[model samples]
Target: MSFRIVDLAETGSTNDWIADHPEDGLWVRADRQTAGRGRRARAWTSDIGNLFTSTFAAPQPGEGAAPQLSFVAANALLDTVARWVPRERLSLKWPNDLMLDGMKVAGILLEGHARGVIIGVGVNLAHFPEGTERPATSLAAAGIAPPSAREACGTLAEAFAAHRRRWREDGFAATRADWLAAAAGIGKPIVARLGNADLTGTFEGLAEDGALLLRLPDGALRPIHAGEVFTLGDQA
Candidate 1:
């Protein structure tokens, strides 16, 4: 069973709430998040009628890299969207950002715990904040039929459950293939913004542990651990 709330405001982040006020699977929806966040503390819009969801899972033992959870979560979002859109059109950006026709449709953030993992996912299901130069998308804007917030979150959770099971058995190799098959930019020139330092290189694809493979100008292959990467328009 899933524990859900209807009208919550901001309180730092929803993942924090799931950590302290633990539940089986808490679905926290806020009317307005004063300080909604994304990767690297970017301001996330929490406008009404959009999806602001976070799911906390009890941890399980695993052998592969721990950070593969983001891949699993990203693929889960893609899987859910495939129920409506053509799966071939879905692809994953560096990390777990979801792309459709090269524009960002949704993205995921995964937080780990001692006994469980809290995954915070924010999807632009309806609207986006204005003045944002970065391209943003919505489910309805993308031609997907509208559904209630509860229904959308439930659908993603169901899809995530199935992908999580595959992550347990198949390892990152299988995860990378699934993501690459639907990738928007596989081999192309792109710029990687890793904070601290930025590198421009050719986007080769994903490594075994989910890191992006970048072939620099020197003909040297670089494996990026985690960074904000932008695939050129051509790649997209």
Candidate 2:
């Protein structure tokens, strides 16, 4: 499906903009954001040369459509970035963040409104924020000249449509398998901070419904529906 792209010189946030102007098949992008944000309302530094966009789509009738779409978005991002970066150096962090060599290169945020769900994506093209909880990297810092925001959005829209088609036809199992194959921190020790409590465990993988399966020290398993994860040795 072709998406209607609305390019903005500056905005508060693509996600917020799309939220206020709810419409299906719309892709809203801004060259610079005055109020960009990430998960848990963390302020995202909107440098002049990065990709900040949001796409709106109606949720499929199902219990897990939101989480399933998150996986679809991740796969689409992986497909787009893999063209310029080596596949071996890139991995999808569970739920949203995309990593390049263990550092965050991109982030995805999904918000539901009266009209549809908005998939907000921010990629570090020419610059990355400093002093973040997790270390961040950019395509330019990784030695490849980053694509223009418009070019990257074009690639993302195409890739997202392809993955969405696959999800519609093949279902979540297929997307889950693909996401797991490209997942980072699986089989490694990690910490999950779920609001007030923190749990340290081994990253087993994902459950069928897309919840994170974390095996604790006692050998029991915990399904984390939401949290911030950190690979054991990485700075968080």
Candidate 3:
């Protein structure tokens, strides 16, 4: 499907703007966001040099579950980033974050609306927020000059289209395999913060349906569908 790209010099949030203007195959991008946000409504630092964009796309007939798109978006974003950085240095974090050399370099936020699902992506191309919950890094800091926000949006649109097709044709099994192969912290000790409660366990592989399979100390397994996950020893 062809995408309608809307580039704004500044906005409150690309995701919010997309939400207001819901249309399938519409891509909203902003040079800077005054009120950008991530999952859980956490404020995202929207500097001028980074990439802030969101796109609207219909879910496959049988594959509209929210979490599924997170994986698809992760795969797409990872694929786009791989073009500029070494694949070995990039990894997919559970739920919807991208890691570069063990630090967060990009994040994905999925929201469902009447028109379609909004896939909000924020990539640290030229700058990353400091003193954040997790360590953040930018592509420029890693010695790579990323494409402009507009250019990156075009690349992301193409990549997302391809991955979306792959998911539709092969189902979650295919996306799951690809996501796991690039997953970080698998089989490692980690902490999952669910509201006021925090659960510590080994980061088992993802369930077939996309839930996080966390193996606790008592030899029991817990399927986490939502929460903030932090690898052991990583400052949260």
Candidate 4:
């Protein structure tokens, strides 16, 4: 399906734009976002030269749950970035982050809207935020020339559509498999901050339904549906 893409010089947030517009197959990409944010409502550094875009995903019957779209988006973003950067330098972090060389390079946010789900994506093209909780990197930082925001959005839109189709046709089984293959930190020790508590365990993989599979010290596998994940670097 063709997307009605709106390229803006600036916006408060692409996700919020889609939230208000709610048009199926509509996409909003901004050169700069005045109020961009990631999961848990953390402020996102939306400077020019980065890719800030959001697209609406109309509800589809028999498709995986809305939250599972996070993986779909992650796969798409991974493909998009790999177009410019070496694939081996990239990996998808649990929940909604794309890691480049163990530092965050991209983030995905799926927000439920009245019409469907709004998949917001932010990629560090030429710049990344400094003094953040976790280390961040960008395409330029890795010594690769970054794509223009518009160009990156075009690639992302195509990748997202393709991945979404796979999710609808092949089901979450295939999508889950693809995500796991490129997932970061599998079998590595990490910490998950769960609001009132923090759990440190080995990153096993993802559960059948997209929950994180964390192996506790006792060897019991725990399914984490929601929480902020901190890699060993972040803990250090």
Global lDDT scores for all candidate models: 0.74, 0.89, 0.89, 0.91
The positional error of residue 204 in candidate 3, measured at the CA in angstroms, is: 1.0
What would the TM-scores of all predictions be?
A: 0.87, 0.96, 0.96, 0.97
Clashes of 2: 0
Candidate 2 residue lDDT tens string, 98-120: 99988999999988788668899
Model 4 has an lDDT value of: 0.91
User: Judged by lDDT relative to the true structure, which candidate is superior, 3 or 4?
Assistant: 4
The segments of candidate 1 whose C-alpha lies over 4 angstroms from its true place after superposition are 1-12, 23-27, 233-236
Q: Cα RMSD to native, each candidate?
A: 2.9, 1.4, 1.2, 1.1
Candidate 1 vs 2: which has more lDDT: 2
lDDT of 4 by residue, 27-63 (tens): 9999889999999899999989999999998888768
Instruction: Output the worst ten-in-a-row residue range by lDDT, candidate 2.
Output: 59-68
After TM-score superposition, the amount by which residue 83's alpha carbon in candidate 2 deviates from its true location, in angstroms, is 1.7
- Report the lDDT of model 1 for residue 67: 82
TM-score-better candidate, 1 vs 4: 4
